[model samples]
Target: MLRALVIVPTYDERENVPIVVARALAATPDDVHLLIVDDASPDGTGELADGFAATEPRVHVLHRAAKEGLGPAYLAGFAWGLERGYEAIVEMDADGSHHPEDLPRLLGQLTDHDLALGSRWVAGGRVENWPRRRVLLSRGGNWYTRLALGIDIRDATGGFRAFRAEALRRIHLGDVASHGYCFQVDLVWRALQAGLTVIEVPIVFTERVHGVSKMDGAIVAESLRLVAWWGLRRRLRAAFELVVHRRRLRSVRANSSRVV
Candidate 1:
């Protein structure tokens, strides 16, 4: 069995953390371990995680000083797993939106692809208990992201994914800047840029039943701003490359004329 570590980041998810951790442990193979990275939840989520880590050998906890952001928390987890020599690292939500049962399918796909994305927008993929407005918003956001980034991935914002350590290392996690849900988009874009093979597996995303959601208006705004900025930068880089190529062609022609 391949050695894998599932990194679940939590913030005030005291109610959901234990259930998610248990499910992840039961659902995955024996070789797969779970790491809970808690951002000093005032609700004592870190304490709860510590209790689990005490008895469960496969379980571990990393406590941060305060709520930093999803991106930083995951980066910290990834670094820890890499240092420990885990071959595969997984990203999962502390909330139940991402089912642990689907982990095997996602990790299995890593045999051929460097990244296996548990996509909620692909064929056979669906979401439960989501209102029509929320569904529309998610679909529209993914469409906009696909167009802006010029990536063919169907679910750019989905958080559930499995990454081969080799591919994750190539992405240079230090350079990642997104701190909100857009962190998913940023990493996928980076993987594509690094020439990593990315494949999506369909999965159902269910809304969380416990704890308050972390999404806010500011996070949404940040995602939009970053996506637009990246799109513009890509366009500008392309245009500059075109100009350089044209200049090189002109110089080559001038030299040919002189030789003639």
Candidate 2:
């Protein structure tokens, strides 16, 4: 029953937005509000969200001037929810791939964790109606992410996640630069770097039946590049710190021997 704001970012999702909004609201009836961050969809997705907000007090809308990307839209939503004093902020899809019925379970994990990530690779987690190739792509990408980033998360790229407001503050949103689905990996990296408690909640992922998926070759490429770069940078920094520590220790020993 935390004061939670579910942020759903959309671009040209006219067919799925209303359905998602209604179902999310119905699934989490109390103390959970919906914020539709519409990126000025040419299909009038923003207008549809406004219509819902006008009638349902629990629904809210944030209209952006243009489609920037998923990262920026969610950043804006986080800011909005934080300013209004929401205890938890959630990232959800407007395409219905992330089931609204599973939202409560994600929130439930927040009781003892800083972040609750809805994962498809964990025990009891499964996906439906996904092609074999798509399934392989997702599984391979997640495995690569874990190996390259050295993070224990099984689904760092999954967009279905919940964050305690304090955890978001600790992650330093101002430093985030990723714009695509890699943004999910970036946030997870930052959360781990910041030493925040993170847990994964298993959920069933269903492929969107409506609009075309936003995934593309470019997004996958970006994730690969960023993950590699982060891993390398982390190793270099650790090596440098170790060298510095050793040098300091040697100097301290030499000075002590001289004094003796």
Candidate 3:
């Protein structure tokens, strides 16, 4: 049985936190675990997490000093999952924007792929309760990312995702340059560059009903600029392709040279 660990990043999501956690636990099979990385939310979320941990053996929490954005919290969670020998690691929001029931569906992709994205922009996916403006903006952003990154995956900024342990190992967390939602896009690009299998699963995204949205113009602007900057860096892109090529070449040459 594979040991799957779902990493939920929380910040002042007091009302939504327990609901998300409970739903995830109920939806997932026994082999899966949950790790909540709280940013020491001012609303006493950390204490709530601690209390939950005491009763639920599969639930654990990591409390940071303050809000550090989504990327860093996920990185911390990934490191924690790695240290504990988890076979699959997942990322989801604690605000219930990401459906807990989708966890198994994402994990199922690892049977044939290295990463699975719960994509709202895919053919069978949709978004509910988002203002028309936000919907258009998100679609446009995703379109820009796909064109710039030259990747086929939908919903590049989607946070609900599952990674095969090997895929996670290939991604050097220290080298990730972006934070917030852009970080999600950058990581997917890296995974594809490494020649890992990437799959997108359709999902309906709904705005969090109980908490304030963490996304804002700042996040949107950062994502646009960062992805564009990545696209414009031709030299850097070449270097990245070269590294992947060299790695593949070495593996091929080593296999051919072996005396069997």
Candidate 4:
């Protein structure tokens, strides 16, 4: 039995936290536990999390002092899961963009994969209630990152994902530099580089109606810059390897032909 834990990062998401927690718990079997990482939202979300943790055996809470970036919160939660011997772990939003019902499907894909991504760019996935600009912005970012990273996984920036604990343990947490949405892209790229199998599970991303969205132009811009930088570095490394191989091949051919 793979003991799983869902890490939900919350900031001023008072109204939707309880609902999302319940739905996530109800949508899965009774064994999957949840850890809500609240960044001390002024909306009393931390207290609410405490109340729920008091009652639910599988539910836990980690209340931070202030609002930090999403990646750091999840990093903390990941460490917590690791310490407790969780076999698998997941990261999700408390604003309800990540559907609780989709957790099972993502987990199921892990049987044959090292990581399973809930992707919006894959077939059968959709976005709901987003403005035209938001859609275009997201689509453009996804396409740009895909080309820049030279990777094929759709929805590279999607946060709804499941990882085998051993795989996550292999990745260096200190080397993960991205502090925002781009963190997802960095992790996926690094996991691929480590020769781990990653599969996409189609999912719909819905805009939250009750709370302010954490997505911003700055995060998108940061993603573009970081991805481009990594892409250049990867390309340069590959070019160097190719040159070395070609030189070796030419030397071998000259020795073998021996026409002189």
Candidate 5:
């Protein structure tokens, strides 16, 4: 049996942790384990997770000293799973935006692809309870990200995803720099660059009903800036490589002409 770990990062999500954890465990296969990565949520989210872990053998918790951001929390969770010999690692949101019932579908797709992304913009995918402006922003942001990064994924910023351990290893998780929502986009980009196959699974995204949203203007701006910077860097590196290749070809032809 391939062992899988569903990593849920939480911060001040005291009200929703138990429900999400229960649903995730119920939806996953027997081999799938759940790990709650809590950033020392002052709301006692960590305590709630520990309570669950005490009774459930499949559930575990990693309590961080402080809120270091989503990226770091996930990194820590991934490392925890990797060290424990899990073959697949899943990324899920604790606020219930990502449905645990869809976990089986996402993990099933991982059999043929290196990554399975639960996307809201794909066919049969939809969002529930989000206002028009929020929907438009998500759509436009994904469009912009695709244009900038040249990735064909419909929901590059979606948080629900499953990754094969080998694929994650290939991407070198330690070098990931995004500490916000852009972290999703960064991982997708790196996985593609490493020549891994990525597939999207349609999923319904729901607005959180229990707690405050973590999204902020600063996080959005940071995502935009990082995407633009990465795009520029990719272009510059390609241009430099082209120049170098042309020079080498010209030098080779010149030598051939002298020999002739």
Candidate 6:
């Protein structure tokens, strides 16, 4: 049996933490463990996670000093899981947008692929309780990401994802600097760049019933800026390589003519 660790990052999630923990534990096998990465939320979310950890052997908590963004929280969680020798590491949201029931399906995909993403933009995937404007925003962002990065993934921004430990090792987690939703895209891009196989599994993403959304204008602007920069850098590298290839071909032709 593959040993897996599900890393859930939490911040002020007092109302929803227990629900997530219970459902996640019930939904997966005994070998699957839960690590709640709490960002020292003022509402005592960390204390709640500690209570669960005490009673449940599979449940553990890592308390940070402050509320860093989602990216740092996940990065820390990944390090914890990797150091502990888990064969698989999973990223999940604490507010219940990512269904614990779907964990089995995501874990099953690791048998063949390096990464499995719970994608809302893929065929057969859908979101519940989201407004039309939110849907459009998600779709548009995904579309733009695909076009800019020239990748085939349907939902690069989705937070529900599973990673093979080997894949995470290859991804060079030290280089990842983006935060918020952009962190998701950054990982997918890095995985592809590392030649790792990635697959999207259809999932029903439900809006959180408790807690306000963490999304803000700043995060969105950062995502857009980083995506565009990466795209531009890729295009420039491709053009430079093309120029070098053409120059080499011309030199070869000239040398052959002289020899003739």
Looking at candidate 1, what is the lDDT of residue 18?
Answer: 83
The backbone clash count of each candidate, in order, is 0, 0, 0, 0, 0, 0
Which prediction has the highest lDDT against the true structure? 6
Candidate 3, superposed: residue stretches over 4 Å from native: 234-260
In terms of TM-score, which candidate is strongest? 6
lDDT of 4 by residue, 152-192 (tens): 97788889999999989877877787888999988998899
Q: Candidate 5 on 199-252: residue-level lDDT in tens?
A: 999999999999999999989998999999988888899999999999999999
Error of 1 at 140 (Å): 1.3
10 residues in a row with least lDDT, candidate 5? 1-10
Q: Return the lDDT, model 5, position 118.
A: 95
lDDT of 1 by residue, 26-120 (tens): 99878999999999999999999999999999999999998989999999999999999999999999999999999999999988989999998
Which residue runs does candidate 5 get wrong by more than 4 Å? none
What lDDT does model 2 reach? 0.93
TM-score for candidate 1, residues paired by index: 0.98
Deviation of model 2 at 233, angstroms: 0.7
- The candidate, 1 or 5, that scores higher on TM-score is 1
Candidates' C-alpha lDDT? 0.93, 0.93, 0.89, 0.90, 0.93, 0.95
C-alpha positional error of residue 66 in candidate 5 after TM-score superposition, expressed in Å: 0.5
Candidate 2, pairs of clashing residues: none
